[model samples]
Target: MLAKIEELLEQAKLAIDSATSVEVLYEAKVKFLGKQGSFSHLLKEMGKLTPDDRKTIGKRANEVRDILEGKYAVRENLLKDQELNSQLEAQKIDVTLPGVAPERGVLHPLWRVTKEMCEIFSRLGFSVRTGPHIEKDFYNFDALNIPPDHASRDLQDTFYINDGVDRKPGDFSPWLLRTHTSPVQIRSMLTEKPPLRIVSPGGVYRSDSDMSHAPHFHQVEGLLIDQDVSMADLKGTLGFFAREFFGSEVEVRLRPSYFPFVEPGAELDASCPFCKSKGCGMCKGSGWIELGGCGMVHPLVFKQVEMEYPKWNGFAFGMGVDRMAVVKYGVSHIGLLTENDLRFLGQFRP
Candidate 1:
C-alpha cells in the first residue's frame, strides 16, 4: 500500500509538470483528488487492513497526498502564467504603426455666439459676470419696476415655482428660475460699487416655446454704469459691436421699445448680412434683423440698489444668443440648435 501511494504521487507530479495549460493542469488535479480518484480509493481500502497496517498505510497516503497537492498548486500557477504570456506574445502590437485618430468635439453654436458676444463687450472694457439661475422675483421684476398685475406674471408666460402661496401673488422674495439675464444687472449693482461695466452670459428659463423660441436658452446681457453715461454712449457701443460682429458694411438701427427696467428702451437692429439690406428669408425679406433690446437704466432700478437715484446712470441690453446664432448660421429652426444630432452639430466645428 505504501508503494502504491508513492506511485500515485509520482504520477500526479509528472502529470502536473507535463500540463501545458491551466485547463489541463486543473483536469489532472481533479483526477487525483476527486471522489473516485486514486487518493479516495486508497482511503476506502483502510477498513480491509489490520489496525497496525492501516496506520502505516494511512500515514504514507497522507504524506504523498500533501506533497502532490503542493506540487500541483505550483505547476497550476506556472501553467496559468505561461498561457497568459503566450496570448500576449501572439497579440503583440506594432509600436511604429499609425495610431487611430480620435473624433474631436466642438462648442455648440449658441455657446459660440455667446462667446463672440462676450468677446465683443470684453474688447469694449466690459468684464464678464454671472448670477444664480434661481433668483428672487425682486431682481427679475419689482426691482426692475415691473408691475405685479402685469401679463408677464401669467403662468402661460413665466415659470413660477409656486402659486406664491403662503406669500401672495405680488410677493417677489421667494427664488425662481430667472426668465432672462436682466437680473444679473441687479446682482452687479448690489455687489459692486458704481463705474461698473459687465456682460453676463448664461442660461435662462421661460415657459414659452415656438418654432423660434425655446423653454430654455442662452442670453448675453450688457450693463454699464457711470456718473455721466448717456444714450449716445449706448448707441456708439452697440454700433461698434454690430460692425465688429456682422462685418464693416453692416448698418444698425434702434426703434423705440419698452421694458420695465429701462425708462427709454429700444430694440436694436442690424442690416441682414445674407442679403446685404436687399431682403432675404433670414431677415423675413425686410433686409434687417432684430438683434436685442437696450435702454438707459430706469432710476427706480438705482433706487432698489441704493445707488442714489438720478446720481448715477447706465445702459442695459439683453440679446438672445440663440437668435444671433440663427442669423449668423442661417439656421431655420431653433430646435436644430438643441438637438444633439452630430451631423448638424458637426457643421459648427470650431
Candidate 2:
C-alpha cells in the first residue's frame, strides 16, 4: 500500500507539471482526489491493517494530498498569468499619436443675406414681423383689395394648396401656400391699429424655377401706416436703405408701375451697386437695378381692412430676398443657395 501511495504521488506531480491550462489542472485534481480515485481505493484497503499501521498510512496519505493540492495551485496561478499576458499584448494601444482635426460648420448664405436685410430694415425704425407660411385668400388677397379680376394675380404665378382654378378668386379656399409675405400686412392691419410700422421677412412660394428664380424663395415686405405717411417718406426711407445696404454712394428712383392694392404703385431701383450705373453683365447691361415695388396705401386697400378709409395713409413695398442676395454676392445661380454644396457655402462663413 505504501509503494502504491508513493507511485500515485509521483504520477500526480507529473500530471500537474504537464498541465497547460486551468481546465486540465482541474481534471488532474479529480483523478487523484475524487471518491472513486486511487487515494480512496487505497483507504478502503487500510481497514484490514492494524490500528498503528492505519494511523501511519493515514498521515502519509494526508501529506501526499496536501503536496498535490499545493502543486495544482501553483500551476493554476502560472496558467492565469500566461493568459493575462497574452490579452494585454493583443490589446496594447499607442499613446504618442497626434489627434485628428474636426470639420467646422457655418450658416447658409441665404440666411446670412436675410440677416443683413433685416438688420438694415431694423435700423430704419421698421420692427420685424412674421406670419405663417400658409395663408387664407382673405388676408392674402381680399383684405389687400386684390380681387378675382386683379391683374397682379396673373403675374404672381402662385402655387395653391387647393384647386384654385376650381374656385373663384374671391371664393377664398380653406388655405394656400402664401404667394408673398404681404399676407402678413393684412394680418397686422386686422389685429393692430394705424401708426403700425413693420417689415415682414419670411418664405413665400411661386410656381417658377430658373437661374434667377426658385420655386420657393424669401420676401421682405415693408409697411408704414400713419395719418401723414407720403410717397416722399417712402422714397426717403428706401433711399437710406439702398445707400446703407448697397453703399452710401448709390441713388434711388421710383418708376411708374401698376399693382391692384395701390392706386399709384411704382417699381423702385437703385444705381447698379455692381457697376454704379455703368453697363455690366450683373445688371444685364442696364444702368439701373430694380430693387422692389412700393406704393402709397390705396383707399381701397384701407377700406378692405375696414380701417377708417383715407383717415390713415401709408406706403408698402416688397422685394425678393433671393435677388437681393444674388446681387450683393454676385452668385451665378439661384439654385446654388439650396444645393448644400460645402465649398460654395464656405465662402459666406464669418
Candidate 3:
C-alpha cells in the first residue's frame, strides 16, 4: 500500500506540472485524492495489512497528499499570473499618439455684421437701444407718422397678431410683430427726454420674401434728437459710415426719395466697393449701391410722441442688416442667412 501511494504521488505531480490551466490542475487533484481515487482505494485496502503496517501506510499517504496540494497551489498561482499578464497586454494603449481635436463654433454672419454696424455707430456717440419684436399699433405706425391708411399697414405688408378687431374702444392697442426698428425709436422717445442719440437694431417681420427679401429680417435704425439738428448732419454721419465701413476712399450720394416720416427723405447709396464706383455687374453698371433710407423726423412724428417738432427735431435712418451682410461678404442669396446649414455658415468664420 505504501508503494502504491508513492506511485500515485508521482502521477499527481506529473499531471499538475502538465496542466495548462487551474481547471485542469483541479481535475488532477480529484483523480488522486477523491473518494473513488487511487489514494482512497489504497487506504480502504489497509484493513488486510497488520495494525502496525496500516498505521505506517496512513502516515505515508497523508504526507503524499500534503506534498501534492502544495505543488497544485504553486502551479495555480503561476498560471493565474500568466493569464493576467496576457489580458493586460491585450488592453494596453499607446501613449505617443496624437489626440483628436474638438470642433469649434462661430457667430452667424448676420450677427457679425450687426455687431460691426453697432460698433461703428457706438464709436460716434450713438448708444445702442432695443425694443420688443411684438409691438403696438400706436408705437409702430401712429407714433411714427405712419397713418392707418398707409400701404405698409395693409395685411399684405404687415403681420398682425390681434388684427386690431373685436375689442372695446380704447381697451388696448392691437398687437403685431413690428415691421421695422423705427418702433424702437418711438419707444425710446416716449420714455426718455432728449438730447437722445440712439441706434435701434433688432428683428423685424413683414409679409415679404424673394431673392433679396425675407419674411423675417433685421434692421438698424438711428435717431438723433436735440436742438437745431439738420439734414447736413445726417448726410455727414452717413458719409463717414460709408467711408469707414466700405473703404476709406468710398463716396456716398443720396437720391431724392419720399417716406411718410421724413420731410425730405432720400435713398442712401454708396459707391460700389467692388468696382470702386467704376461700373460693374454688382452695381448694374451704375457704380453705386443703394444702401437704405434716411431723412429728418416728420413734424407729426414729434406730435405723436408729444415732443415739440421744430424745437426737438432729429434725423432717423434705417438699413437692412441682412442686406449689409450680403453686400459686405458677397453672399449670393439673402435666404442663405436664415438657413442653418453648417456648410454655408462655416464660410463666415472670423
Candidate 4:
C-alpha cells in the first residue's frame, strides 16, 4: 500500500506539472483526488493491514497526499494566470486609432430665448423661480384674481386635470397644467416674504394652436415687489430688457390692455428690430411686434396672497418665448421652433 501510494503521488506530480490549461489541471485533480480514484481506494483497503503495517501505510499515504495537493494547487494557479493573460492579450484596445465623432447638439430655440431673457433679468437683480408644471386651481387662477367662471377657465382655453376620484368643478387644490408662469409668483409670495424680485421661466399649456400659437409653449414671467414700486419702475425695467434683448436702438411701448391679475395691464410691444421700426412684412407693416403684457400687481392679487396692499407695490410681466425667438431671429413661422429641425436650431447656437 505504501509503495502504491508513492507511485500514485509521483504520477499526480508529473500530470499536474505538464498541464498547460486550467481544464487540464482540473482533470488531473479529479483523477488523483476524486472519491473513486486510487487515493480513496487505498483508504478502503486499510482494514486488511496488520496494526504495524497499517501505521506505516497511513504515514506514507499522508506524506504522498500532501505533496500531490501542493503540486495541484501550484499548477492550477499557474494555468489560470496564463489563461487570463491570453484572454487579455486577445482583447487589447488600440489607443492610436482616430476617435469616432459624436453628433453635436445645441439648445432648442425656445430654451435659448428663455435662457437669454432670464440671464438679462438676472443681471437686473432678479432671481429665477419655478413651480410645478401641475399646479392647483387656486394658484393658477384664483390667487391671481381670476374667478371660477372667468373666460380663461373655460374648457376651450384651459387644460384642467381630472382627479382619479369624484371631485367638484373647482376643489381647493384642483390640479391643472398651469396656463402661465404667474402661478409661480403666487407660490413665491405664499412661501417667501416681500421685497421679492424673481423671474419664473417654464413651459405653459393652453388649448390653442396655430402658426403663431401652440397647445404647448414656454414663457418667462417677471415679478418685482418693494415698498415704492410703480408703473414707471415697470416701464424702466422692461424698457431696459427690451433694449438689451432686441437691440439698443429698439423702442418699447405699453398700450392700455386688460388682464385680470394686473390693475392696469398694458400690451408690451417693441419696435421691429428687423425693419428698424419702419414698415415691414414681418411686423405686418405696423413697425411694432407685440412682445407681451405687463402691469402693476392687482390689489386683489395681493389681498389673495395676504400681502398688505399698497404697502408692497410691484409689477409683473410675462412674455411668450416662441414669439420672442421669432421676433429676435426673424423666424417666419412659429412651428419651425418646435419642429425638431436641426437646421433652424443650428442658427441660434451660441
TM-score of each: 0.72, 0.70, 0.83, 0.70
TM-score of candidate 4 relative to the true fold: 0.70
Q: Total clashing residue pairs per candidate?
A: 0, 0, 0, 0
Quote model 1's TM-score.
Answer: 0.72
Best by lDDT: 4
- TM-score of predicted structure 3: 0.83
Compared with the true structure, what per-residue lDDT tens digits does model 1 show for residues 151-186? Answer: 776677677676455865555435678988888888
Clashing pairs in 3: none
lDDT of 3 by residue, 1-350 (tens): 67778888889899999999878878987888778877888888888999899788888878898998899889999989988999999999988989887877899998998888989998889999999999988888888888777888887788888664687743433688999999889989999999999999999999987766688999988999999999899999999888878889888899889999998899999999999989987788999999999999999899888997787889999999988888898877778889899999988767
Which candidate leads the pack in TM-score? 3
Error of 4 at 345 (Å): 2.3
Clashing pairs in 2: none
Return the lDDT, model 1, position 241. Answer: 93
Q: Distance (Å) between predicted and true CA of 96, model 3?
A: 3.4
Rate residue 38 of model 1 by lDDT: 74
What is candidate 1's local distance difference test score? 0.87
Each prediction's Cα RMSD? 7.4, 5.1, 3.7, 8.8
User: What is the per-residue lDDT of model 2 for residues 180-282, given as tens digits with 9 covering 90 to 100?
Assistant: 8988998898899778889999899877776667889898899999988788999999998888888999999999998777768999998898888887987
Candidate 1 least-lDDT 10 residues: 164-173
The reply for model 1, stretches above 4 Å from the true place, is 1-98, 163-173
Regions of model 4 farther than 4 Å from truth: 1-101, 167-173
Better of 1 and 2 by lDDT: 1
Q: For residue 75, what is the lDDT in candidate 2? A: 91
